[model samples]
Target: MHRLYVEEITETDGLIRLSGQNAHYLTNVLRQREGDNVLLFDSSGQVFDATITDAGAKEVVLKLTLQYRPKEEQSVAIVLCQGLIKGTKMDYVVEKATECGVSEIIPFYSTRCQFTETRKLARWNKIAIEASRQSQRVTVPVIKAPVSFSDLLSMIKNQTDSRSYIFYEKGGTSLKSQVLPDDIKTIYTIVGSEGGFSPQEISEAEATGVTALYLGSRVLRSETASLASVLLLQFMFGDMVYS
Candidate 1:
């Protein structure tokens, strides 16, 4: 079944109106018609089975049939504290990170960051939503506005019951050496931009209690590093479990 993301869904059984972009997507883009069934999900982590009751040029109405709430599992929240990279690279990070089960993305501007002026929160959010839909995720990752490096440090320092790590190409503890804490509620992984992190920035982050991690001897692009860090952390701490 095709899955569509709605901002919120309150009624468990009723006719729901979908207009604007969503309506156009179902009617024109997907060529869905009346009586077609679609899966609808919202940020509340609820999935609904809906059948198209009315299909019009301006709007499409869906009748909620059933609600399915997945079994809750023990998972750590992953937050990517990414250094602002230039152009489409940042967009790729947001898209892939959401698919990789990242809970939140915080783009920060460090000393080595190239692009610090423009904030693409809207574009990133759109990418996140599409990625979530494609990945069959019930909830979309929150893409926060870019913040300064110092501000990012402060935010990490203030977060309780969370473990933070900064991936530095220079040198740091390997992922295998660190032990995953069972009580950790959130995991914050920091990756630098094309220029990478400066020594001073690494020191500042370390002083703020962020562990420095190295992704082996291979040099990776800014976008590659961002995805790698998220995926690795997800496997160890988040929802990427081996069955």
Candidate 2:
């Protein structure tokens, strides 16, 4: 069954009206017709089975029924603090990070970042939503607006019950040496841009209780590092465990 993201699916036992882009996506893009069954998910982490009742040009109505709700909430939340990279590379990071089960993404501006004034939160959120729909994630990751590198560090410093790690190519402790606390609630994985992080930036981050991590000897691109770090964290602490 096809899945679509609806911001809010209020009436679970009745008809729900979808207009504008939602309607266009179903009726036009997906060629959905009346009687077609579709799955709808909301930000509340609820999935509903929706049957298309009417597939009009501008409006599509769905008959909704409660389908699934997560049995338990995720204990560990993974957040990606990605340095702003070039155009499409940043988009790729957002898309793949969402698929990797990141709970939130914060784009930050650093000294070595090429695009300082880039603001693509809306586009990134769209990509996240689409990725969530494809990945069968009931909840979409929150993509925050770009912030200064200092602000990012401050945010990590102020967070409670969280462990932040900055992946630096220069040198840092290996992941194996660092024993992650089982009770840690949030994991912040910071990845630098194409130019990577400066020595001063890494020092500031370290002062804020952010541990410097090394992803082996090989250097990776900004996007690759972001995805790799998040996936590794997810497998260790988040929801990517073996069945």
Candidate 3:
């Protein structure tokens, strides 16, 4: 069954309304109609099996069947503090990071970042929505607007019950050597832009308690490095639930 994320839903209420682009997708693109079955997920991490009760021009209503699955979240939550990159690279990072079970994604401006504030943030949010649906995630990760390096450092340092890591080529320690704290439910990993993080910025992050970790001898692109680091963290601290 096709899955979608909805903001408005109630258990045992027997009704769900999907409007906006999702309704359009089902109506025109997927060609789905009344009586078709699909899955709906809410931010609460609940998946409901629902049947299409009505498909109209303005909205699509689904009849709540029952809870399809229980709440299933990754053991180790990951928030990717990704540096702003050019073009669609940020889109790719959001999509893949969703698939990799990142709990949240924060795009920030670094010393070497190439994007400006005028760029469309809605497009990035849409990519995250689609990716979450495609990856069967029960909840879409929270994405924040771009922030400055110093502000990001402050936020990371203030995070409660979570560790922070920065994936850099010059990182002295391998990622595998580090372990998630027993009480920590989440971890934040920061990745630099095409030009990587400046030494001063790295020092600031380190001063804020973000550990630097190395991938390997060969350097990877921004997107590749971000995705790989998240995957490795999940593998070590959390099971490969998507598999």
- Cand. 2 Cα-lDDT: 0.89
Residue 109 C-alpha lDDT in model 1: 88
lDDT for residue 59 in candidate 1, whole number 0-100: 88
Stretch of 10 with least lDDT, candidate 2: 65-74
Q: Write the per-residue lDDT of candidate 2 for residues 1-243, one digit (tens) a residue.
A: 999998988774588999999999998889999999999988888788989989998889899865776534368889999999987998999899998888999999899987777667888999999999998888999988889999999988999889999999989998768777777899999999899999999999999999999988899989999988988887777777687
Q: List the pairs of residues colliding in candidate 2.
A: none
Clashes of 3: 0
* Tens-digit lDDT string for candidate 3 (1-243): 888777656644678788888799888888889999888887777788888899999798889887866567877788898888888788899999998888889889887887646365788777888898998788888889888989998988887988988988976588768866689988888899999988888888888898988888998999999999888888888767454
TM-score of each: 0.95, 0.95, 0.92
Give candidate 3's whole-model lDDT: 0.84
For candidate 1, write residues 55-168 as lDDT tens digits.
999989999999897535337888988888888988899999888889899988888887686757888999999999998887899888889999999988999989999998
What are the per-model C-alpha RMSD values against the true structure? 1.5, 1.5, 2.0
* Candidate 1 TM-score, true structure as reference: 0.95
Deviation from truth (RMSD, Å), model 3: 2.0
Clashes of each: 0, 0, 0
Clashing pairs in 1: none
